[model samples]
Target chain A: MKAKKQAASIAANAGAWLITAISLVPFLLILLNSFKDSLGASEMNLKLPGLPLQLTNFLVVVEKGKLLTSFFNSCIYSVASVFLCTVFASMASYVFSRNRSKINRILYLYMVLGITMPVNYVALTKVMMLFHLNNSRLGIVLLYTAMQLPFSIFLIHGFVAKLPVELDEAAVIDGCSPMRLFVSVILPLLKPAIATVVVLTFLNTWNEFVSPLYFLSSSTKWPMTLSVYNFFGMYFKDWNLVCADIFLTSLPVILVYLLGQKYIVSGMTAGAVKG
Target chain B: MNKNKIYPMWFAVLALLIYSVLFVLPGLIGIGYSFTDWSSYSNQLHFVGLENFKTVFSADENYLKIIKNTLVFTLGTTIIKNILGLALAVLLTKSIRLLNFHRGVMFLPSVLSTLILGMIFTSILNPSSGLLNTFLREIGLGGLAKPWLTSPHYAFKSVMAVDIWRGTGYIMTILIAGILSISQDYYEACSIDGASSWQKFRFITLPLLLPTLATTTVLNVIYGLKVFDMIYALTNGGPGKATTEVLYTAVFKKFGTGQYAIGTALSSVMFVFMVVIGFFMIRMMTKDEVQE
Candidate 1:
């Protein structure tokens, strides 16, 4: 019986190793080929060091793709949208929590619909055109913020409800105005919910595809994802440079995940549990 | 008290306006337009009841194939994600020293953009010099190597495989959270009864993990239905449309050709389908929750 259990354990370990290998192999391929010349990398040989590794492919991709500008655009979209989502969600959540009115309840339910329904991009494109917000970065940011608000509100609402009402009462009795109370007392205490919102929104916005695809017409204004798409189309033959570009585009998010895996993992699990 | 009532309204005003105008309004308008003849060439709006739907269903047999593909893609990915996710969750929760590291590595791909992953894999799966074929040849399985992205037979499965690969870790993490939440007392009780490993898993873990598994399955299904970016970036419904062509892709193509009304109709179909699926899933999950 003991031997049988040991064999089963060994099988499990082997299975785990196989999964890890499969998961890592693509990334490994990209990393190794990114250093080789275009032909050498495309040859798909894994054994030898494609020796004398240099930064040529990376440099070319950066220069040609204007990686810095697209990176900045991604950062702008993510940061601005996350800020919008958090501020609006926090305020709305605070209100929803504080008020038990029929209107608030109905609005909360209305907001929850966004979680299940796919965004109507056809009409969205038309509306953006009507408002001259189409084909612009700000338009995408606004839309991203709007798209994310429902889930953010849902998350922050639950968190806000748990804060004791006594805190609000105390602040009010201490002569704090409603706005000032929310600003000074409530916002600071919403740190955990805010972290979740930030991580969730940032990742969503950073990796957003459809919004930018429809909204941003100009190549210069493209986020890294869109730029990468266009880059793939333009340089489909140059596997080495393409690998370099892929690595460049993916590196920042990977770095962020490595740095704050806890926040991301917690936020995601929190979302799943609530969802 | 009056201030409390009014302030809440004030705080909600901005979010409501933006959401209503940008999200809800557009959705409603899209649904409305789905029944009208609102193509780019048409100057006047005409009510074309059921015409778009008919065309979607019968005009070319391609639509049927698309529907089939979408269902296959959805059901395929959903099942694979939940199964693999549960397996990983069960295995990784063991007393492995590098458990956290493995979990992190598994999840790393989930964080990357599907578009980027698609583009990366496009080259990696190329027929002639792709790493996959190269590896297959090296391992004496050259017979299995084929044009992964471009082949009609392999493209859909390839796309689904990539989707499952990227998504399983996410489901695993969620399941891990669920499994971790299961009290040790239950396992201890089972062990004291001399329950075999298979018996313990089947009787204890499976029952407790049902709700989480349900959650993952529903999430996967919903995501699968809305799949666009990865397919767009990878195959783009190519190799002569052999890969899975979902509703969103159909709608996208309709709009590309200035078929606004038809595109809107396709989207409406997608929306209704999703809502129905979501309703049933919620009902099923809630019932399971109540039973638990």
Candidate 2:
């Protein structure tokens, strides 16, 4: 009986390891191919490079794709969108939490609707044309902000509601205005939730593909994702270059994840639980 | 009461204005456009009534298939993701070293862009010289090697596998949070009473984690309905549209083909579908929450 139990334990452990390897293989293959030449990548060897690493694919992808311009464009959209969305969400969440009126409840429902509503680009295009938002970075940013605001507000409101009402009471007694109170007292207290919103908005805005694909017609104004797609379309047969482009496109997100892993993990789990 | 309320009602009004203009107004306009015979070719727009919906529902066999595919994809992904997520969460929560590393590895794909991941998988799943097939052949299991994305029977399955791979970690992390919140005293008592791991899991863990499961499942359902990037990148709804196209892709195709009104109509159907489904799910989940 002991021997059988031990054998089962060993088998379980091995199974777990096997699953992990399987999970990691796709990523590992991409990583390996990113360093190989076109011929080598076409062969799709699971093994590491047998020859010296070639920088040519990376260079070609960068040059052909005009990656630097697209990277900068992505930065503009991501930063502006995240900043605006976080500020608006935090402010809206604050007001919605403090006021327990019919309007607040209705607004809360309205915001929740945003989460369910898909971005109706076909319809939005008419509005965009009306506002001349089509094919513009500003236009995309506004749409993103509008789309993200609901979730951010929902997340922030959950945290805000739990906060002690005493803080607001005391601040009010001390003659603090609502704006002042929110900025000084409530805002400081809402750091973790704000951090959560900022990271999420940042990630979503940075990696957004569909909006950019539709709204931004000019290649000069395309974000990294659209740029990567264009690169692949233009270089359909160039697997090596395509892999290189993929690596470049993913670098910023991977870097952000590594740097803000703690905050991202906590924020995600918190949002999940409270949301 | 008045003195504390410095921002006044207009601030709320302002926020509402942005919400209405950006989100609500667009959705309403979308419904309106769905009724018209609008397109890029002509500015003389005319109301087409339910013609577009009729076309979508009856004109093309693919539309119905897409809807079915969307349902399957969403149901399949949500069920599998949550189950696996819960199981993994329970296992990883055990007293194991390198738990953090394993957690990080699992969560890695969630952080990467779907477009990039799609490109990577496209190469990896290629049949002629793809890593997956190459490995299969080397192991003398070459029969299992198949053109994953190209084969109609396996295309949707392939897309779902990639999605599961990307999403399971997220669900796992959420479940872990749920599991960790359960106090250990119950588990300790169970162990003292000679309750086996499976019994403790089935009784204590399962019931306690219901709320989290409900919330996570609703979120997954919303995500599943809106799936576009991964499918768009993976197969572009190709291999003769064998994989699930869903409403979003249908709308996209119509828009791309310059049938703007029809596309907006398809989108309207999606809007109504999502709203109905989303309302039902939220109500169900919140009712459960109240019970809990």
Candidate 3:
């Protein structure tokens, strides 16, 4: 029985390693090829990068791919959207959760229903043109904010319900203004949930591709994902440069994922396990 | 305390206004535009009843194939991702070394831009020198290798495979959370009754996991239906006539060709389909919350 248990443990461990390898291998291929010279990376194998890594591939990609401009654009979009999305989502969810009137309930459902509603990008152009937000930075930021609000609000609404009403009463009795009650009292208490919102919003905004692909026309204003794709198209033959470009584009997301792993897991799994 | 003052209605106005104008309003107008002769080439809108949707549903057009592809992709990916995710969740939750590391690595694909992954896989799935075929050749399985993305026969399946690779980890993480939340007391009770491992899973875990699986399914369906970035980056709905063309990509192509009416019609179909799904999803997700 003891030997059988030992064998099972070894088998499970092997299974786990094999699965891990499958996931890691693609990323490893990208990383390895990203450092190789064009000739070396041409075949796209698992071979180690050369001894003197062709770090120049990154410089080439940066210059030709307009990495600096796109990276800056990506940051601006992500930060602005994260802030707008979190603030609006939390505030809306707070009110909706605290004040559940009949009308509000319907409105809440109406807002949350956007969670699954596919954006009609064709008709959206008309709306964008009507508002003169067709190809502007502020327009895209607002678009992302709107896109992210449903899920963020859903998350915060569930969180707001767990907070005690007495806290609100205490704050109101203490002569707190409505804004202060939310910003000073409730917002602080909502830190964990807010963290989740911030991480998810940032990640989503950073990785957003379709919206930019549809709306943004100028290459100068493109985000990293769009720019990377454009770069791939133009430099299709240069595997080293393409690999390097994608590596750079994916770096921020990977770093953020590593840093905020807990919040992301908890955020995505929110209300999913409540059976 | 006045309910009006503390939790002001203005708080929600920004969110609702943005969502309405930018999100929901477009959907409504898109449905309306679906019936009209709306196009970039024409300035004036002329009402044309069911013309575009007819083209969509007609056997004469490839739009039907696109719709079918979208449904097949959604159903296929959702089911497979759920199964694989459940299996991985179960495996990783066991006594394994570096378990968190494994989980983190697996989940990595989902967080990164699917477009980038799609681009990466294009090279990996390249027939001759791509990593996959090369590896197969190295392992004496060269005969097994085929043109992954270029061939019409394999392109849709390849796209789905890449998507499953990206999404399975996310589902696993959710399932892992669900499994963790299952009280140990139930398992202890089962063990005390001399329940075997498979029996414990079959009786206790499977039944309890149904809700999480449902949630995962809902998430997957929404994602699968709206799939654009991956398909756009990987296949771009090509290699043949509407082979891998899902709704979003087809809508995009229609819009790209200055055919606004058909694009809006396609989106409207998706809008209505998703709303129905969204309704049931909301009920299922909030069922326990409402009770509590």
DockQ each: 0.53, 0.52, 0.82
Report the C-alpha lDDT of model 1 over A166-194, residue by residue, as the tens digit: 88888888888888988999999999889
Worst 10 residues of 1 chain A by lDDT: A266-275
- Candidate 3 has a DockQ of 0.82
Candidate 2 residues B1-292, lDDT tens each?
6622654554455456666776778778999988889998998999888887787788456777887788899999999999999988987787555677778878888888887778778877888887788888999999999989998888899999989989998899889988988999999999999998899999999999998898788888889888988888889887775465777777788889899987888777778888877676545533322110
Docking band of candidate 3: high
Model 2 segments more than 4 A misplaced: A1-13, B10-15, B280-292
lDDT of 3 at B166: 95
The 10 consecutive residues of candidate 3 chain B with the worst lDDT sum are B283-292
Instruction: Write one digit per residue (lDDT tens) for candidate 1, span B122-214.
Output: 777889887788888989999999999888888999999999999999999999998888889999999999998789899998998887787
Q: Every prediction's TM-score for the first chain?
A: 0.94, 0.93, 0.99
Cα-based lDDT for every prediction: 0.82, 0.81, 0.93
- Which stretches of candidate 3 lie above 4 Å from their native place? B290-292
lDDT of 2 by residue, A149-242 (tens): 8778877877787787788888888998888888999899899888878888888888899888778888999999999988888876767788
Better of 1 and 3 by DockQ: 3
